[model samples]
Target: MVVGYWRLAGITSGLACAAGALQAQLLVRAALGARHTSTLVHDSIITPFVLRPALAPALAVTAATPLDERWTAQVTLDFSTSTLERHDADGTTTGLGRVSTLAFTVGLRRPLGAGFAAGAGVGGLKYLPAGETGIFRSGAGGVLGLAGAVVSYAPPRVGGRWQLGIEARYDVHRFITPALRSEGFTSARTVHRIALALRAGRGGAAGAAGAAGAAP
Candidate 1:
């Protein structure tokens, strides 16, 4: 009985210490609109088409913890739903039904003064296809790895613990699949995306009043 009591006490203290060490600030955001450039999927043989995802109307959530006086560590999660579009040589386009994209990234952010901040990070992107068709006949490239970066602007706190801001983000990744490889394509195409959104978060006044970007 004494050993059991000691074990329970150890567990409780461990939980308390973890909770005290990892104080995180949360931010919720929604994309005003988004866009992706057309990239060549396959070239020089068979039916060739360029691929692009109609990006818009997405949402994101971010959690951040201050690492120092000038830097903060953050993780962001975002997702979008759209049609996977294919463009032919003749410039005609076809929609490949409903597709969903989910992404997660870890990054560091620092204030650039005057309500501006810069951040960069790396992440993974997964494509969920509605059906087995088009280039996704085998699967949407198996969770392509990606690199992402962001810039944001947050005004002075509006007399509260939560704050509002705007952010611009960009991501890049290589696109390929077993289906593409089987179709005589040997190389992966580079895909790029850009987005803008409005965000509201718990630590908006981090850097504005010489708070040094620390979460309160």
Candidate 2:
């Protein structure tokens, strides 16, 4: 975990330096939505362990800068938490627990239409057990590689500096725990989410020229 944090810090610092040199337009976006997550565990000597679909609230914050008229570079941070329950062979509930995740991604976005855009990126994810016990109890928390895609729409300028939009995102990653590995198991986690966001920033030719002129 400590090493993971250091890696994230280094990546962030490098991006900050690059942003400064490019004189990229600064844009901040905040979103809120619901997330659905599921995990599939493969184990030797037994059937796979599939967790029930877990649905929870999701939130995200993003910082973006235009690389050109049609492309933008951005970094996003997302979070979600949910309760999961295990089922017995007969489909009866055996135990229940909680899991939470934090993810960071850096990706590129391209305009799809006048008000729509799409993006794809890769980053890192961390999973933590939240008040979880029983068979799912594993103090092991680890970080893994993550990849995601996003589709968003922002209405034309609403007479202000802020623009409102809707976004849908999907993420894929792997989750493995000491407890699972101890039992010889590996898991894959997937998340789907949708959100409404407010974007505040400037871009395009005029914005780029201004930013470049202000660069040191």
Misplaced by over 4 Å in model 2 are 1-24, 42-49, 87-95, 131-136, 186-216
Model 2 per-residue lDDT tens digits across residues 40-113: 34232364445543677778888777776667778999987777666545556643677677889999887776
Q: Which whole-number lDDT from 0 to 100 does residue 124 have in model 1?
A: 96
Among these predicted structures, which one has the highest lDDT? 1
Model 2, backbone clash pairs (residues 3+ apart or across chains), number: 0
- Best by the TM-score measure: 1
Per-prediction TM-score, please? 0.79, 0.70
Name the lDDT value of residue 196 in candidate 2. 37
True-vs-predicted CA distance for residue 160, candidate 2, Å: 3.6
**Tens digits of lDDT, candidate 1, 1-216:** 999999999999999887654442233334344645356364643766667776656677777766666777778887877887777888898877887778999988888887788889998988788988767898877778889888888776642555567788888888887788898878888888777877666633334224444231
